[model samples]
Target: MVAGGGMGPDDEGISFAHALATLKEQGSALLVVGSVPEELFAKASRTMLGDPDADPPRRRLVVTPEPNPESAVRRLRETGPLSAEYARVISRGERARSAAVADSFDEMTPRTHVVDDSIRGLGTTIADVIEEFDLFAGGLEPAEFRMAFDCLPTVLATHGREVAFRFLHVVIAQARSVSGLVHFRLPRAVDSEAVGLFEPLFDATVELQVDGDDLHQRWHFRDRDITSDWLPVGDRP
Candidate 1:
């Protein structure tokens, strides 16, 4: 059975806040799989990171293959406060390295770590950075940390399924060890075969769809073998 059965929906559908709270209460690290439009994903990421002003502030890490760290920071800031210690950005690849260096002048921007793809593979670089972040926390509880890996498709495209699978295996173990909530975004529609290939790595899979101005999501819990009804993405509580 799922650890938190009370989170199951009624006839009316589930609220965004209730779903998030249940996930946190599940007491183990979660690997949530999902893909959505970029804008909606960003909003969901912000929600998952929690309110900056909320109690027991969380440490956030964003790993992106995008070239512009500034643009990422700007998008994050659109939702809530982003402090240097509260959040860190890992800019991956050659282009990102250049962009991160150029954007280093702003103290207000989240600290960016540039990982050059030429020197190290994506899996190694991500693992190393996550280790460093963990070490830097120095005894902070794992639940205090959250990570958003924004480029699974890019990783798969660059390294192929076998390599991406190996990378995810290691990274998911890392997240579970720390008891952190970490999510990887695919950003595009994938066939069932592909989903089946990656489904075992995650605790839950969230499928998202857009219809006109309404955004909806459905959740699947692997361990309990339960799938949620499609619920509208509402404002964060």
Candidate 2:
């Protein structure tokens, strides 16, 4: 898991996705918590999927709480990934039904899915988010899928600890059910007391700090067999 403190919000998602892309060897699913801007999250998505030439077709899902899902898709188009042709966008944000963002990917434009107004959309409440997650998780086949949550601090701050804890517990269970890897990027600005509730839940944790143009990272693990130290942002594990 990656925790963003002094590190820029954009870097938090980008770095997390960069790491996950390098480490993922199987199908994956991403659950973005909207802690970072839509543009940065899109970059992270592009990074996580990698370039078409080096990527194999894998089951993948990109879920977000943005009002305009196209905002995420457009940033992805800018990444120049040839595989963008395979993407489809689903808009569930009730504030806007259509993705008004301009696209440069031509035929690679993403298709949209809209939920009826009768139902709640993303970010309306913690329960709504959990229900949406369950719907997404249920559609996945029984296989390995890497799951990343951009920033969980938003959840805890929005609904309180109990709700966020239940949400994480459900998400972790969903990931473990298929033996998928789960990583969450949480903002360090949150109360350390509140953040403490999540540290023990992860098998490993990473602390991210930004210094000028450089990023420093430290890793902690439950086993403590691996030695880790502050490393350059782009350095691979």
Q: What is the lDDT of every predicted structure here?
A: 0.65, 0.45
Q: What CA root-mean-square deviation does each model show from the true structure? A: 4.2, 9.0
Top candidate when judged by lDDT against the true structure: 1
For model 2, name the residue pairs that clash. none
lDDT of 2 by residue, 1-237 (tens): 334455655666566555444334332233322234444434444544334333333223334445565554564354333242233343444553544244333456544444432212322332333334445446433332333354365456666788777667766665555545445666553235655677656655555555565555555543333324565444322
For model 1, the superposed segments whose C-alpha errors exceed 4 Å read: 1-22, 25-35, 78-83, 118-121, 234-237
lDDT of model 1 at position 139: 43
Q: Output the lDDT of residue 26, model 2.
A: 37
Q: How do the residues 114-173 of candidate 1 rate in per-residue lDDT, one tens digit apiece?
A: 776532455666566566656766744645667778767777887889988878888878
